[model samples]
Target: MCRLLVMFVMFLIPAWALGAPIEIAGRATVVDGDTLAVNQKRVRLWGIDAPESAQQCADPHGKPWPCGRRAANALDAWLQGRTVRCVQRDVDRYGRSVAECLVQGDSVNAWMVRSGWAVAYREYATAYVGAEQLARTGKRNLWQGAFQMPADYRRAQRAMQGEDTRAARVPPPGCRIKGNISSAGARIFHLPGQRDYEQTRIQLHNGERWFCSAEEATAAGWRAAKR
Candidate 1:
């Protein structure tokens, strides 16, 4: 924003302008259950959150299943040989586009939640509440058995890793991400070129693992360290 525009918005204007939603149409690659890659842009599905690829949760019977991976596979099955269309909402902190996407005229995000493979991220939006309620009423995916909410699962997993402090967060051979435990009991991935990246050391026993990209780390339930 221009300096004048910022000042105007802060002091002179009573309302802020909202950008018109953008439309992206193309073939897409499934980044995960809730994210897509279209025309070289990352698009996070709006209003829903899916399990991380490496996350595990118990079934109604208390048996463990790769629910996260299952969610990804479900999305892949839904998108196979299909073209994707997305209406952009905003850019996320990571700079990826957040969007409501459609495949073959069906709302992809809504389907995921309605079919029980995902949950409505109420922290973001309530647009999918009806679909989510239906899934729950039908004892759908995550509801079919007891499981942690996606965000809660991520938070708890990071906390466990952080409390261990016994292993290194292995960046690929040249990856400079500093996997460090935070006081909040979170395993934080510090990227290369950040101020504290060099000072953070790796410990082999803290359940440290290597990730080739930030996407991989995030999909595996790790969060980036704050600047």
Candidate 2:
């Protein structure tokens, strides 16, 4: 009966504790509101999400506010160059350790959420829900204004970047010849050694391209520069 009880206790032990507990401690550098680096190791505050560094929010009057940088500055001032200790809870997809960090015995993660610099990341953990509720009710920091969730903001930014990348034009590899359409509607191809080649710019959106050879350029209805 005693052996069975011991086995049951072992089964209930946390997986992270079953092995050596991962603990990092050092003077911290604030990477953002919910992230810090100690001894050059990145640690993400667990159970909370802060605005991205470039993200913006709206104030009560609907004016744009740099809430992202504000959150980062708030966390930095709160830290005050103190040593931070963090215990690893999990590893995030970005290779950062998701941790519950403490400074002077106070939980940094709870402070961020409670102070409204960050929001409780309900998708991963609900431990800070009460603190978040209190912050919201009190209209602290971000709670006093309108802002998108950090994750949603990141997704929106990524979508915009993807569309921009798709709309951009790039020259093909080894195609050093520039095909330009003059103002007079003449299709001209500039070679590497030609005089105007240095000044010629290919605007792909205006139906320009880089040609691999003069033959190819002429075949595509572009005449070589007279020079």
Candidate 3:
């Protein structure tokens, strides 16, 4: 039962779930840079974000390396043979529990940001700002090189997926709308001028299909992008 669930979430609690926050502790499974599965609950560290595992970043020179994988590896190393505990702080749009986690009383969130394996998610909280500054100043881990901000990387990935419909100057026949699956498994549609339109490359191999109109997409079970 506890072993079957998996999740990814982001920050700041609503007034209701704050008091007597859910406390979870267990062996952890690393889902990504900032996500962990503890007691079978997918817990997203509140107020921090790590690069996606597939993302590549460059140094000052024109070079490319797997910075995203590095971030994930850093977290995995930090969690090795350790007991992880987290207090649920909130719930995200994706239904993941947003929490501040610790390993042997050390704030895992703080360590990740301070060590440059993660960044402060300013959109959520200011608790990790000081640590983030230290990481920036020291040029530790991810701070040592040129990398896309996690949020930007996500947007670009989403956009790139949208460009897969035709892969040419023109879209395939009438399938101009881009239907991309997000990391959360949501089906999103991208149109011209949308953030992901030009970058999204449709993948027919992934069961991703194309639509011709907003109405057609809506009818086929896709929603428009909020951004």
User: Model 1, poorest ten-residue lDDT window?
Assistant: 12-21
Question: For each candidate, what is the lDDT?
Answer: 0.83, 0.90, 0.84
Using TM-score, give the best candidate's number: 2
* Candidate with the larger lDDT of 2 and 3: 2
Question: After superposing candidate 2, which stretches have Cα over 4 Å from the reference?
Answer: 1-18, 169-227
After TM-score superposition, the amount by which residue 204's alpha carbon in candidate 3 deviates from its true location, in angstroms, is 6.5
Writing each residue's lDDT as its tens digit, candidate 1 over 1-227 gives 69989787667533224344578889888888899889898999999999999888788898989998999889989899588999988779999889999988899999999999999999999999999999999998778888889999899988877755533544457655556666676877878788787777776565555556788778777898777
> Please, what are the lDDT tens digits per residue for candidate 3 over residues 78-186?
8895888898888898889999998889999999999988999998999999999999999887877788899999998788766754463456687788887787989
TM-score of each: 0.66, 0.69, 0.67
| RMSD vs true structure, all candidates | 13.6, 9.3, 13.9
Per-residue lDDT over 1-227 for candidate 2, one digit per residue giving the tens place of the 0 to 100 score: 99999899989997676886689999999999899999999999999999999889888888989889999999999999999999999999999999999999999999999998899999999999999999999988888889999999999988976654443344567788889899999999999889998887766557777898999999999998998
Full-model lDDT, candidate 3: 0.84
* Count of backbone clashes, every candidate in sequence: 9, 0, 16
Question: Runs in model 3 with CA error above 4 Å?
Answer: 1-18, 166-227
Model 1 RMSD, rounded to 1 decimal:
13.6
Sort the candidates on lDDT, descending order: 2, 3, 1
